[model samples]
Target chain A: MKQRLVSPVRMVWLLGALLIVCILASFTLGHYPVPLGQLLGILGSRLGLPIEVSWTPQMETAVWNIRLPRVLMSVLVGACLAGAGASYQGIFQNPMASPDILGASAGAGFGAALSILIGLSSVGIMVAAFAASLATVALVFTVSRHAKGDRVLGLVLSGIMVSSLFQSATSFIKLVADPNNKLPQITYWLMGSLSGAKWSEIGFILPPMLAGLIPLLLMRWQLNVVTMGDDEARAMGVNAPRIRLWTVLCSTLVTAAAVSVSGMIGWVGLVIPHMTRRLLGADYRCLMPGSMLGGGIFLLVVDNVSRNATTAGIPIGILTAFIGAPFFLWLITGKGDHYEH
Target chain B: MSIEVSHLSFSYGQRQVLHDISFQVRQGEFLSILGPNGVGKSTLFRCVLGLLSGYTGQVLIHGTDARSFSVREAAKHIAYIPQSSRPIFNYSVSNIVLMGRSGSLSTFQTPSKADEERCAWALEKVGIPHLARRCYHRLSGGEQQLVLIARALVQDAPILMLDEPTANLDFGNQLLVLEQAKSLTRDGYTVIQTTHHPEQSYLFSDRILALQNGRILTQGAPSQVLTEQTMAQLYGAAVTVVSLYQDKVRVCVPKHITIQEEAK
Candidate 1:
């Protein structure tokens, strides 16, 4: 008999409810502690509903300007990264694969570091990072094309080599920067914090994220065939190489955009997809959306903790690693067979 | 003819694998390719599938040039089943079978109600309708082979090509898979398979093609092609052919080298 824990429809409904609850709770439970009634009143007033203006302008700014943008960015970036990771895992047919498996993160890091060293504006840095990430994947694809046997294995090996190449370039940029000003900026950016997130930056990320993610959603079912290995997929009349190329391109675009905005947040991409697979089956129709929602909630909760945990906001990259590593260890030790087919 | 190949030759950068191979398969015929390891059986299959290019050959499927057909177009006429291996993901059996319909599906379109009905029919035809909802990876080897056969059956192609269908099966399971292949021929499907077992070819195949040293050594009816002399020449070992049950069953047994030396 098939062992199903929860039907996919029910799982989707449950995740949607949890996401809504998490968003509302995050808006209310920050350091400033806006009351729920006032929060609703503020929203209701903006929507032109008759509600009392019980909150001060400072509370209004904190909710709308400060907290809302960060929270929204958290959800968007989280969904993009996790969705891209799931797509990569399917294309490569490896559960261990993530968004950065093909050096997207490393390439973006190098681009951001170089831009910061040359005194580029904030927007310039992000644009450079996004471009470099795509460039890195293109380079990796070219190298793999020259490799003779086993195309998937070739891509993975070349990805590792290209990643190291970009990482060293990033290190070189960090070495020559001014220590007090430019070095600290570069280091903090690499460490990843959402403290200074703004509506404009969120606007910058949305288009590319959608451009990459929408195709992934549409091709979700096709991903099942691609993951079945190349020969089988070819026998099914799928252009395996072409589908793989499209998947990689879309995944790289979204992952690069997310990393450029958030500055190298880890673990959400790698862990959320596995967690989703364990809850739902490996059907990408369910796995893709499940990972997106799961990643959003995970990052939102983590960002909430980062802001409220102390006076100085902890770097999100550190916190994700702090939480992600232990959780991954537990999953490995307790439920290793869940990953094995 | 369902499939016709003439003077097919292939090489891997100066290392020749298949040399001057020519054969024709008629409608509803079961052709068994018998060869030792590294005798270019798989390479020949790849060439037929249009997976390997730069081969000197003329392969026609239903009087259409195979080389001119795109991969998808070729798939409409011929379906391929690789040897069954454990998949990395535990997808449902129905989902696995539905992938066979991909050749006919338009881009961005999900499987429709008709496609689902076809998948159901395939599972029923294979006599494993109960396994449709079960995880594919949990099935046994024989069951997995049957599932793959059903997957091919769902392709709706007239010609089916299998690579070592019973390569990993045990004795009884091997017979089970072979019987399934044999049954497909009776349904007007042209089935071609590569196998190492000569007795299986004798029992189920309408024709046998023996390959040795990257060349065809013999090609004819099983009775004419699978003689004791040809069997010994193909394997480079002494073998004896025996018949039983009023000469209705044929088997090949290899002579023991140690016993022969002691007697000498």
Candidate 2:
């Protein structure tokens, strides 16, 4: 047990293997069940390998159109949320910080709700959400700049203020929405789902997600020092303000991208980093990558269960809380002394 | 001089925290700033470390204006060990110490193998090599202080500034931390520290600077600066400065404690 606790590299490798298995399982276990052998052939054939085409045309269409996009979105969004969550925790030096701390998710939700009220296309909703989320964080930063004392506290308070501002705007949109059509659409979007994942949406969100994740991954070491607090980080030559600005900007970028595409998926960003911290100590160097991989595996499995648990598809945001909260409680309770409140 | 502060003053809006304070510390000198809580010792150190700006006067580290240097360049000249704060996350001792090399590394770079070796060497030097892989939060206060000192060691700066390095330790642990700091001064690092205890200044510091309301009240060799009158004025309590071990050491006792003993 201690051996497992000590070796984060090995655990990361294990998570990597588990993710590959989950992706393969998620591919085969969806609504239109494709067998493992034919699934491999389809994937291989798509990659230009000369594999025999024994799968049906509908099966291929299901694999390409529905399963592939959802699978990739789950993995990509999970990694992005978890990575951004870990970065937020590090830069803020607050364990409670998540990707939503800066109002990105709330802002994105409002954007989607407003776009839906205006009857925008699916892509238009994603774009509007992306824009609104960025704007919300920008407003938070501007407000916090004028706040007196403690930059971290200022950012957090303004974030709460702006987030609730946008949330009320979303509620107002819901109140005014057509009860027969737009209200339920807004409610379901707020709860979040991956059922509508499309190849085009994936193509649009992927670049920004990578753009956010790469800089955060590269700056993991700096993230570790930032956790020591601003004065200490600066004293150690880490340039705390610059690192903070970059972290907020990047974390906000990834979070906005994730929320715009997947709606307000909650618990992954909040709990996944904590889970990874328990598995691989709190060094962001390992914690960043670990949370990324762990998040991907978790969401993929959760997404699979959400789709396959019953005849009707459950909104993933609800399931994430239903699944994540209990699991998180179990993790904290077992060897409860290890965690700080 | 390793560090020079001349006519330094700071205010937090309407409240003046520090008045004109001037001092110079030479390389290889252990200068202890002695004061009670809220006397602005920490604020003074912050000014010296370039963590604070908008002061009235100049702070020079190695004869260069502190404000001109970037955080990295300032760190290269002087490393700081803050009070042993309980961190939110539990990083390993080695990992915590290895962060000392961050100033030398680029923004995108992590610690190299050489940096790892240097961290190990610092832990060994601080006599906590066994705790390298142990979680930092689980360590005793004394051990944590040592870990921070080791971190400062790995920073490889010529000057080390500690903000009350022993404020929260037990009696034996306090000596342990002070001795480690004194040893660093012997290794030719300029050490400046703040503390409320005059005995700590007497035992470890080559010179003592006493502060009252953020202004320099007195400064000189420990014997001259820590007299009974100065101690009483600084703490607002009568204290008897006692010489020990053939005048080689001294300690202060509150007058009431001595009176109570005599009554007993």
Question: Which candidate leads the pack in lDDT?
Answer: 2
TM-score (C-alpha, index-matched) for candidate 2: 0.96
lDDT per model, in order?
Answer: 0.87, 0.90
lDDT of 2 by residue, B1-264 (tens): 998899999998899999999999999999999988898988898888888898999998899999999889999999999888567887888888998999999999989999999999999999999988787888899999999999989999999998888889999999999999899889999999998888878888999999999889999999888798998888887987889998678888878898899899
Tell me how far the alpha carbon of residue B39 in candidate 1 is from the true structure, in angstroms, after superposition: 0.6
In Å, residue A67's CA in model 1 sits off its true spot by: 1.6
Q: On residues B1-264, what C-alpha lDDT tens digit does candidate 1 reach at each position?
A: 999999999999999999998999999999999989999999999888878868997888999988998768887888888887566776778888888998888656678889989999999987899888877887788888888888889889899998999988898989888898888899999999999988888889999999998899999998887788899889886777778777556787666754585589
On DockQ, the leading prediction is 2
For all candidates listed, what's the TM-score of chain B alone? 0.95, 0.96
- Residue-level lDDT tens digits of model 1 in A1-341: 33556787578678878998898899888678888888888878878998878889999999889888998889888898899989988899898898999999999999999999999999999899888998998999999999989899999999999999999999998999999999999999889877888888888988989999999888887888888887777777888788888899889989988998899999999899888887777888788889999889999999999999977889998999999999888877874334222
Whole-model alpha-carbon lDDT for candidate 1: 0.87
Worst 10 residues of 2 chain B by lDDT: B84-93
* TM-score of the A-chain for all models: 0.95, 0.96
Question: For all the predictions, what are the DockQ values?
Answer: 0.46, 0.59
Share of native interface contacts present in candidate 2: 0.70
Residue ranges of candidate 2 with Cα displaced over 4 Å = A1-6, A334-341, B254-264
